[model samples]
Target: MASGLFTFRGKSSARADIMLGLGVAAALILAWEAVARAGFIQPQFLPAPSRVLGALWSMTTTQGLLWHAFVSTMRVWVAFLLAAAMAIPIGIMMSSYRVVGASLEPTIDFIRYLPVPALIPLSIIWFGVGEETKIFLLWLGTFFQLVLLVADDMRRVPHEYVEIAFTLGAKPRQVLTDVALRAMGPTLVDNLRITLGWCWTYLVLAEIVAADSGLGFVIWSARRYVKTPEVMAGVVVIGLIGLVTDQLLRAWHRRMFKYL
Candidate 1:
């Protein structure tokens, strides 16, 4: 059983996997609690998980934590959907047509390499400190990266699929839609999942500059007053949200592509 649990390239039941992950997490939390109780680290620097949970409860009950979380979630989803709407088509075009790829790839490559925080100032200038700026910043962070991933997914569709479509007397557009798009469905979903995680990461950067609410704002406000537990609580909330989103996407992927 021990060897099976640690087997190389081996699969385990979902229950076993979940138990293993939970056990590790519980152990880490217990260790953290012990260290905090023993004064191995200052509470202000690294609070115990229990303290963080307490802070989370306090904030949720009295400090509008739920509202802030909702705002941040909305911002992330709006920007992510917008990015997906634009990037998927642009990426398909880029991958399907050499001219589109040549024209857009260089510019995308250049912009994506630029640090997102650096763009914050320009985003502010472009869209002011309103919700637009926040959404744009989040969109910017995810869009470039997602577009590349989308293009790569489209490109990775086997040539034989296209050939078979053509052999069946399919039109060019049908080949693109039925053959290429369908072939890349799983990978495209995977790319979106990956990029959605990227979108969440940019939320702090998006909200830190000029926002009054959201998890990032809560975290930053707590940091200003040296409220370590609140800051850690905010971070924990974001991690939890991201983890839930990832798992949902994974389940969707598994359901949609049962053969895989």
Candidate 2:
């Protein structure tokens, strides 16, 4: 691979697209700053970019911000990985077995339609205000979505490839592992972006309910004290962190499938 404009000889247009996207972002920021200074918007509600950045700076020197970020991220990591582990197998099973799919379809659909927050009272009542309760919130919200997505995706895997796998003396299990999953991989890779957002939502729910620390906890605490800037600061820090993580994941995705 080359650097800069030659990074991909055919991707000159991609570079121009990137430039255009950045130009639009810059324009928005400039407009926001101009509007804020002209008193067209209240800083208290929609703070200027400079004030938001300053709040982020202030949070950096405080121990709470880093702790909050780390705690929230760690919880999300654990919950998301658990959900993925449980979901992938169940999803595969749903696609593989007619009985299982028929049995689960209605139940899963009903659960998906139900609001996870509505179950919070039950979750807290059953699990108490503990980590289990928080994890349940995350698992409940994400598992059904992942199961449906992965199962439908698996069902759509090119039948010809699976048929060929069977013709080659491969077992059903072998075909599923080597053929079906391979076909569904690109979509699974795409789901990672959605998974990140879902994980963030789980973090918010966890912090709102039982957490004494974490980004959402910080937000809640700041709101109580009317420290709007600190809350905004936490939002900025979280956004920046999420952007960095998302970029890294996207880069990995590109690198892994670049040859495709």
Which tens-of-lDDT digit does each residue in 126-170 have in candidate 1?
Answer: 999989999999999999999999999999999999999999999
* Deviation from native of the Cα of residue 11 in model 2, angstroms: 8.8
lDDT of 2 by residue, 1-260 (tens): 22454565544566676887789999998998788888876677677788877877777676557877888888877787888888888888898899989999899999988888788899888999877877888888888888888888889898899999999999998998898888888777677567767878767877787878888888888778777777788777778778888888888888877766
Worst 10 residues of 2 by lDDT: 1-10
Question: After best superposition, candidate 1 residue 22: deviation in angstroms?
Answer: 0.4
Q: Please report, as a residue range, the 10-residue window in candidate 1 with the lowest summed lDDT.
A: 1-10
How big is the positional error of residue 200 in model 1, measured in Å on the Cα after superposition? 1.3
Model 2 TM-score, 2 decimals: 0.89
lDDT of 1: 0.93
Full-model lDDT for every candidate: 0.93, 0.81
- Compared with the true structure, the alpha-carbon lDDT of candidate 2 equals 0.81
TM-score of 1: 0.97
